[model samples]
Target: MRKLLFEMAYDGSRYHGYQVQQNALSVAEVVQDAVEVVFKKREDIVGCSRTDAGVHASQYFFHMETALQIPPEAAVIALNNCLPGDIAMLSCTEIPPDKAADFHARYSVCWKEYVYKIWNSKVKNPFLQDRAYQVKYPVDAELLDRCAREFIGTHDFRGFCSAGAKPTENYTRTIYRAGVHREGDLIEFRVAGDGFLYNMVRIMVGTLLLAAEGKLKEGDVTRVLASLDREQAGITAPAAGLYLNWVSYTPFGEENPVK
Candidate 1:
C-alpha cells in the first residue's frame, strides 16, 4: 500500500547482476527476499540500474510497494541485518503518496555516474585484485585527462557501447562530467551523464587508455563517435573495473538537466 525507497551499495563479484534471472543469483533477488522477511510481501521490487556481471556499485537505489506499516528508517536497519555482508543499505525513504503512485526506478532516473578504476602499476595490487584493473603499462594521467575531457559534451556514443547489446535509435547522450585522475598507482576514470548505453563507460575507458598510452589511432575519439561503429573503439574494459558510482533523480515536473 506504500512505496519505500532505499539506497544501497553492493560488491558485484558474486551475483549475476542487479535484476534476477532463473538459475542465477542476483542483488535484487537477495534484497527482495530480505525485504520480504522484514516487511509484508511486496507488490514488486525495482532497482535503478542494471549492472553487468562482476561490476560493483558504490551507490544504488531501489523502490518497492509493501503493506507493512513499519517506518522507512526502521526498515533500513532491519534489511541491513538480513542482507549479505557485501550489500549494505544506506538509507530508506517513503516516497510521497502523490509521487509513489507514478514513480519508477528506471524511467525516472535523471542521470548516473560510472567510474572505471585502474591500478597503473608494474606490480600487481593484491588489495584491488577483483575490485580494479591492474595494468602493467605506464599510463600518463595528464594524457588520459586530456582525452577524457573530449567526451564531456553530448554526442552519439554508439561506438562506446557493446556490439552485442540491443539496438536503439537514440544513441545520443549528454555527458555532464568526465575526467581522469591519478593518485600513486590508482587511476580513476569518472563520467557522469544523463544516461548511458550498455558497456558505454567501459569502452570509453578503453579508448582513453589507448590515448594515455599514445596508442590511439588518428581521429579516434571524435571520428569514432561520429562513425557509429563499435569496432572503431578500443577493447571492452573488464566488468570488475567498473562501478556504478552514483545516481541522481530529477525533481518532479522538471526535465533532465542534459548538458
Candidate 2:
C-alpha cells in the first residue's frame, strides 16, 4: 500500500465543519465521499485538522492509504471533478508512510499558521460579508498589534480558549508568533503556534478586537494570558473570519516556508 497525501482548499460557508457528523454535512465528509467514489472504499482518508463550522481553509492536508496506481496529478483532477464547486483539490502526492503521519510525528511540524480576517469599514461590503468579521467601528491596527505582541511565547492559553472545550484536555500551548496588520479596510490577525485548543484563535481575535475598540485596555491581554481562566477572555469571534492558513513541517531540518 502507498500513502497518498491530498492538499485541499475549501470555502466553509455552507458546511458544518471539517469533521464528519451524524446529521450534518462537512468539508471532510464531502472530500471523503469523493475519495470513496474514486477508491471504492470508505474511511480511507484522514484529515489533519478539525476546523469549526463556517471556518474556511486556504490550505489543508489529509492522508490516505491506497492500492490504486493512478498518478498524483490525475488523482487531483479526478477528485476535483467529484467535489463540489466550493471545495477543490490543489495537489496530490505519494509519500513514505512515516512522512504521512499527522503533526504527531517527530520532526514533522515546525509551526502552524492561522489568519483571522476583519472587515473594518463604515459599511459592510457585500462581497466580503460571508468571509470577514464586519465591524462598523473603526479598529486601530497598531493597538491590536501591540496587544498581539503580549501573547507571543509559551503560555497556558486557557484564558483564550472557549469554555465549551472539554475540561479533560490540557489547555497549555506554545505560540511562536502572533501579530496584527492592516491592508486597506481589512485587519488581519496572524498567529503561528505549535498547536491550538478548540476555538482558541477565535477567542484570541475577539479579545484583540476589544482592545482595538478601546473597550479593553492593551495591558488586559497580558492579564488574560496570566489569568489562565477562560472567563478572562472576550467572546469568541465568528467562525467565518477564521482560516486554517497553512501547516509547516521540517524533515532533514529544512524549513518549509508557508505562503
Candidate 3:
C-alpha cells in the first residue's frame, strides 16, 4: 500500500462543511469524487480537521492509501483537473512504507491557526459579503484587541465551547497568539493555538465583540475564564466568518516542524 499526503483548499460557500453528510453536499465528498474520477478508486482518505458548515479552509490536509504507484506531480495534476473550480488539490507527497506505517495526519499536528474575519463598516462591500461577518454596529477596534488578550495562555475553555460537545477532563488548550488586525474596514481576528474545542474560536471572537459593544462589561472576559461558564461568554459568531487558516505539523519527537 502507498500512502499519499494531500493538501487542498476550498471556497466553502456552496457546501455544508468538510465532512460527508447525508442529503447534503460537502467538501470531502466532492474531493473524494474528483479523486475517484482521476484515480479510479481510493480509500481511507482521512481528513485532518472537521470544519463547521459554511466555514472556509485556506488549506486542509488529508491522506489516502492506494495500491496505485502514481507519481506525486501527476497525481496533483490529475486531481486538480478533475475537481471543480471551488475545490483544487494543491500538493501530493508519497510516503515510503516505513514512514507511512507511523504517520497519522490528525494526531501528528503540533498546532493550528484559525482566523475569524469581521466587516465592521456600516456600508457593505459586495465582494466581502460572503467572505466576512458584516456587523452594522460601530466597533471599537482597540477595545476588541484589548479584550482578546485575556484569551492568551492556557486556560480551561469549557466556557467558550458550544453546548452538547462531549465532556472532556482536559478542556485546557494553549493560545500561542490571539489578536486583532485591521485592514481598512475589514477586521481580522487571528488566533493560533495548540488545539481547539468545538466552536471555541467563534465563541472567543464573539466575546471580544460583545465587550466592544458594551453587551459584556470590561474585564468580564477574565471573570468568564475564571467562572468556566459558557453562559458568561458572548454569542457564537456565524460560521461564515471562520476559516481554518493553516495547520502547522511537526514530525513526532522532532525539533523542526513542517508546514
Query: What is candidate 3's lDDT per residue for 149-242, written digit by digit as tens?
Result: 7788999999999996888879999988888888888889998888999999999988998887888766788889889999988889999899
Q: lDDT tens digits, residues 100-139, model 2?
A: 5443312344667899999999886989966999988889
- Candidate with better TM-score, 2 vs 3: 3
Residue pairs in candidate 3 whose N, alpha carbon or C atoms collide under 3 angstroms? none
* lDDT against true structure, model 1: 0.85
TM per prediction: 0.93, 0.92, 0.94
Candidate 3, residue 140: the lDDT equals 79
Candidate with the larger lDDT of 1 and 2: 1
Off by over 4 Å in 3: 251-256
- In order, what lDDT does every prediction score? 0.85, 0.83, 0.85
Please say which candidate is ahead in lDDT: 2 or 3: 3
lDDT, model 3, position 36: 85
Candidate 1's residue-wise lDDT over 1-259, tens digit each? 7877889999999989888889999998899889878975645788898998889999998888887789888888999999999999998888888878777777878889899999999997788977999889888887788778888788988888887888888989999888899999999999999999988999998898778667774346877688878887888999989999988887423565211
Residue pairs in collision within model 2:
none
Q: Could you tell me the TM-score of candidate 2? A: 0.92
